[model samples]
Target: MAEIKILGAGPVKRGVTQIAAQFEQGTGHRVNVEFTGAPTVRERVLAGEAVDVAVVPQSAMEEFVAQGRVSADTRVTLGRSRMGLALRKGAAAPDLTTVAAFKQAVAAADAVVVNVASSGNYVVKLLEKQGFSADKAVKQPDTVKVMDHVASSAQNLLGAGQLPEIRELVDKGVAIALAGPLPDELQSITAYDAAVTTASANAAAAAEFAAYLELPAARAAMAATGID
Candidate 1:
């Protein structure tokens, strides 16, 4: 079996995991996926970790290409993830139809949980620009843990993360209510891309897997997991 090692961000975890399984079934290849925050994956790849494929935010992929760590021709845009606000299952959903309302909801929360990943970083910057100090906000290392903290928090907490991850947690019976994607004007949509790493041992197989991510079946899997 062709063993392919993949490193990716948390937002793409659910969709990638599903698509990887389909890929394995169809091609008889064994895929080993490692999910982490976007920055961590980028750092590891840049540090020359031995990975066949690297899947990360489009921006990070472009940087890799510029640094000659990933081939530009091999880059494929996988899908986009939108930032979302989540509350505990029994908590009342907040109004997020406009930027002002979103700011208000955030300000009113007793505590807020965010990850240090792409979506969370965007939220933090946006909040700062809006002159709001997320004094009560806590930044976690990744989306899954952020969601977990929100679910278990004794106080009413607002959880901000990528829609795909939040949806996955909800599917797993996590007690949380996803308010929805942030307002259009304030929305941070992160596009993910996949490419064969420069240091890949199995370049041919890695390239094939990167191409497979764009196929209809893989796209469908991504869409099913809120990663369109």
Candidate 2:
């Protein structure tokens, strides 16, 4: 019935794509979702990019609302996920049962690659707390690049990314396997929140979709992507 454009974070590729299709089918709304890095999502919105809705890290919602980039009241949590460990194909999975084992695995790794996003942020803290050298972690701009570096490298490497993104990468043959979710206490969770943009031309439709994100059906669709 209406058309809306959504700017979504890279980690949200799976969840957003899945839900958008269902929303379009159920509502007869033409939904177009563009996936990019989290930083780009913020940059585009802050720079006045025309969009109906956007899904980004919940941590950015306050900033967007404060900047008048998106309607504060339209914000809703779509999905959530925590960091996941990845290792080169056939590499031994780390023993995440204890912090000591995790640290030892890190020390033994020929190289450690991490995306400079939510996943990496949590990993840096975990490494610091365990007294592991953060310098050992090679930071990539995003998860795609992190997986590329790990998969292509001949060295035995360890990488980190969002749980869903890591699994996505594994399917692409980028990372050999997912190593872990880390200790529950040490894992960092990121909430994927969606909001209608202030610049939307189709405010009503955008708001409708934003609200639909909280519906049980939509929430389940998002979770099916392993992001929730």
Candidate 3:
């Protein structure tokens, strides 16, 4: 049996974690997963961490391939994730169908919460381009903490994160309202990709697991976790 160590971003956590268990059971391979922000994952890999496989944003994976940290031939596209907004439960959901309405909602919000990751950075830039200052936006370390802050805070808070991360919390009936995905024009869709690491000791096994993630069952698992 081979043991595979996987490093990935927050958006693919739930889906990958769930599928990893299934992969282990089916192939007798032990899967160890480490999930963090997208930027952190890239930093760790680039810093020469001994990861067997990595699931990261497509852009980051491409850079890794170029840097000879990961095998480009082994890269497999995971699904895409869009930014989404969440509010405290029982609060009135805002109209975010249009970018103008989204701007209004942000302007009227008491406070905005975003993580210090890919989705949050994108939202901040988008807000700035729309003439809104994100300086006051509460930044958390991860998406889960962002939801936790919004859930516990008495203040009316608007939380922004990747759809998969926020949707997982919403599915669990967290004390947050699903305000839906960001408008198309304002949305930043990040494509996720997985590839075997060049430093992998179990390169063959890692390649096998990467291929497994592209199977129909794996795609279904990702879809169930809101990764599509």
Q: Candidates sorted by lDDT, descending order?
A: 3, 1, 2
> What is the lDDT for 173 in model 3?
77
Candidate 1 residues lying further than 4 Å off, grouped into runs, are: none
Tens-digit lDDT track for model 1 on 1-228? Answer: 689999988578888888999999999999999887788898999998889999998888889998889877888988888888999898889999998898888888886789887677788888888777767668998877888888898887999988888888999999888988889998888889999999999888888899999899999998998888
Per-residue alpha-carbon lDDT of model 3 for 1-228, expressed as tens digits?
899999999688899999899999999999999998888999999988999999999889989999999998999998988888999999899989999899888888887898888778888788789887767588999888999999889887899998888888988878998898899888898989999999899999999999999999999999998888
Residues 1-228 of candidate 2 have per-residue lDDT tens digits of 788999988576887788889888898999998987888888899887889998888888778988999998999987778777888787778887676777788888876788776667777777777777768778889888888888889888888888888888777766468888877767788888899999999999999989988889877877777876
Instruction: Using TM-score, rank the candidates from best to worst.
Output: 3, 1, 2
* Stretch of 10 with least lDDT, candidate 1: 129-138
Q: Tell me which of candidates 2 and 3 scores higher on lDDT.
A: 3
Predicted structure 2, TM vs. truth: 0.93
Tell me how far the alpha carbon of residue 88 in candidate 3 is from the true structure, in angstroms, after superposition: 0.8
Query: Which parts of model 3 have CA positions greater than 4 angstroms off?
Result: none
User: What TM-score, computed on C-alpha atoms, does each candidate reach?
Assistant: 0.95, 0.93, 0.96
